[model samples]
Target: MGTDKPLIGFIGTGVMGKSMAQNLMDSGYSIAVFTRTKDKAQELLDKGAVWKESVAELANSADIIITIVGYPTDVESVYFNEGGIIENARQGTYVIDMTTSKPKLAVEIFEKAKARGISALDAPVSGGDIGAKSGKLAIMVGGEQQAFHEVKPIFNVLGENIILQGDAGAGQHTKLANQITIATNMIGVCEAIAYARKTGLNPSRVLDSITTGAAGSFSLSKLAPRMLEGDFAPGFYVKHFIKDMTIALESAEEMGLSTPGLSLSLELYQELAEKGEEDSGTQALIKLFD
Candidate 1:
């Protein structure tokens, strides 16, 4: 491969990752991709992204590896397994984990990468599937300054707002904060719409009235319509949001912080998940009220 651009190895081409990898490919990066579900990667493979047989093969072939898999356990398996990225990647490769995982795990990955003379960054992103498709994600990164700088170009192709939070696990901590805020805001959005419907008011007009005022939020603006239209597709999965909220609650407890609103939101979402709405979008939280 030419030195004009780094070869990118992309793991997990699910809802957001598919669009993110597509943005990188559109920006002229050569990509190698791997995912457990081969059919999910068929689109990227057809778009000139070489399909690697495994994560290690992708690691060996690419100069920069980025992973955005499910759950913290999935993140651990991809990086710490015997045939994982750290062991198979060449020296000096940059490894970036964009999964919203535990901060301690991010630190562990960073330390292991440092021991092998590789650079690692925990770069968790927000803005959901629409943002990913539009290349307008907000990427919060944590790692060495130089490594952050080296990867900024790749991030620029994938997001509109990108910032390096601090070293090691800072990005995951930042993401938890983001998720906490969203948790409460989502409850408010659902309650407002539910109240509007119960009072015989037009929910759409009510949304227009408050959405431009202090009541407006990313959740209210983007997801409220989906709730109204009954489009419960997974822009961001309910199960994944539950995972994020669980992490946030644990972190908050560790810090001796109280988050009653976040706790309530988590409870409501857990009820939804228990009803088999786990595969639905986060907006499906409104379904409980409906």
Candidate 2:
């Protein structure tokens, strides 16, 4: 809104959030952060990002607030609860939720924020942890255009492709479209690698061949290798992917659309969650084929 950089309050310091916040700091924005686990906030704190004891404290002190927490329930708690972001944030402060959450929740937040003279955007992201660390995520934004324009500089620091999809909740709708595609593509990536191993072909060699062809995708290019190496560490967690797929399926059904591939992927991932692989990466879906 001015020549001086806006003070940013960042909530959620885990995995991707940590890197996204660091990038903003690197871009010369002052940051105040709050997270459930104090330990996770340490790296940003060490880098001179001030730590707030509560979400309200962070919201009150910051000119712009960005959150990328887990689950729709968590989103509600952070924004709607007493002593939460909406209750404590100053008038005219901008709130952005980058979490892949329910589109309905995003609209509800927009309505509430509007009543309070605040601007809210549902700006979910893709490209996983690597994207966050490298600042190349694809951000799909939904909210007022002016609000998005105000925050475009902040988004530029965190992503490569930033788009304003439409009014409140549209960004999350776009993200669900993204998750649906990734859901089915992940299954293809896993099964192809599993099939290669079964046929005594080199999976890596197969990857090199197919990754350049029509069979190529982000998961095939990035995660298929992790599956081969037994490196299941999370670039994006299995549980979170399940949450996203569930949201996608529900949204599709409500729109009278059928998403068989998404449903199948959700079924397989649910099996992984049942086996306690929820903390592992989405790449771990290959384990189901094994």
Candidate 3:
């Protein structure tokens, strides 16, 4: 309601959050940050973020609270626990959860926020860690229309593309759609690369050829280069993709739908996770062939 620049408090400064928070600071917003690991906060702190000691403190001290934690459970703990944001945050504060989480939990949190006269939006993102680093993710948001408008400027600073899908958990539903497509596409990319490697073709050349045709895809164009170079460092971890695929399967089951491709992707990621490559990037799925 105020015309002043919003006081922004960001929690979960992991791979994605660190860069996103830096972008916010660069955009001239006052930032307060909290992370489970204190060292993750140093970059943002050096870049001018005021560090908060806890989620509750961050919520209490700022008007806008943005969470980019790892999973549904972590998100729940941060907002529902004894020292969580809801415990100390004032009414009229805005909360945007950017975690790719369960849609049901998103709805539950949004309802609780509404009862307290606070605004909450479930806005999950695509475009991976690179997107976060560049503030160019495609954000799908779901919440009250007015609240969506109120947060548009902040979203602009965080993402290159933003869309208000619907109310409550719609943003997460959209992200599930995103994951479903990604699950299958990544599988296609893996299979193609494996085929090329087995047939003694230059996988890099194969990547270049397909990427210029209709077969071109984000996973192929963006991830194939890294795969060709044998890089498995984290941009988005294999375990996290597994988590997202698991969420997608659960959502499809609830809707009485079956996605066999995603089902297989889930299984493959589980196998990769068991191999202790959980922290590796999703492109490491190529190791399935090895």
Candidate 4:
């Protein structure tokens, strides 16, 4: 930890979290990391991040805390648990949860943190692993305008496209909207490639033509190539996508919104998960068409 730069405590060094934490470390921030699986965080540890055995220890010592854990339940456990962030984090510490979680949970965290004199933000992100490694992620933040501005420098280090969406849970709502877009776009990308293969068009060349056209999308431009090469390794896991879509669907139902496309996408992904493809990448949706 440095005297000038705030001591940043990062919990969860999974696929995207590791890269995001590394980018911050490479940019010269002193980081303290805590993860359930220490082996998952060893790379960052070797790169000089201080390791804390638990979130409580990390929370007590660090000036700022950032988490990108697995799910909404994990988010709740980390922040509201007996030995969690709220209980141990120092006054005025800024805690940011980058997990794509329920909007209401984000709001609950914000209100609780505010009462305790801790600053909290729900700043869920998009752009996946590539964006995390390149620091080009699109970050949507929800919190007080003042806290958002205060954290802008940190956000700038992790992402190029950053926005203060609104207050408390607004960032999460915006991220849910993002997940909805990706869910349907992924299905379209898979169907287009399947069509291309059936017609004997070289999928790569087809991509070159269509990916820059009106049909272009992140899934089409990025994941389609991986699919073509039969690479189903996870950049963003299908299981996580299922979680995001489930949350989005539940949120929609709560508001009495009709989301036929989202509903259908959810069903297909759930089916894929049942086929034991849940751990595979979102690009693996192409397998469903076959």
| Number of colliding residue pairs in each model | 0, 0, 0, 0
> What lDDT would candidate 2 get against the real structure?
0.95
The better-scoring model by TM-score among 1 and 2 is: 2
The C-alpha TM-scores of every prediction are 0.98, 0.99, 0.98, 0.98
lDDT of 1 by residue, 1-290 (tens): 23489999999999999999999999999999999999999999999999999988999998999999999999999999989999999899999999999999999999999999889999999999999999999999999999998888999999989999999999999999999999999998999999999999999999999999998889999999999999999999999999999999999999999999999999999999999999999999998988
Tens digits of per-residue lDDT, candidate 2, 1-290, equal: 78899999999988899999999999999999999999999999999999999988899999999999999999999999998999999999999999999999999999999999999999999999999999999999999999999999999999999999999999999999999999999988888888898999999999999999999788989888889999999999999999999999999999999899999999999999999999999999988999
Residue 118's lDDT within candidate 2 is 95
Candidate 4 lDDT over residue span 80-131, tens digit each: 9999999999998999999999999999999999999999999999998999
Clashing pairs in 4: none
Q: What local lDDT does model 1 show for residue 17?
A: 98
Scored by TM-score, the top model is 2
Q: Evaluate model 4: give its lDDT.
A: 0.94
lDDT of each: 0.95, 0.95, 0.91, 0.94
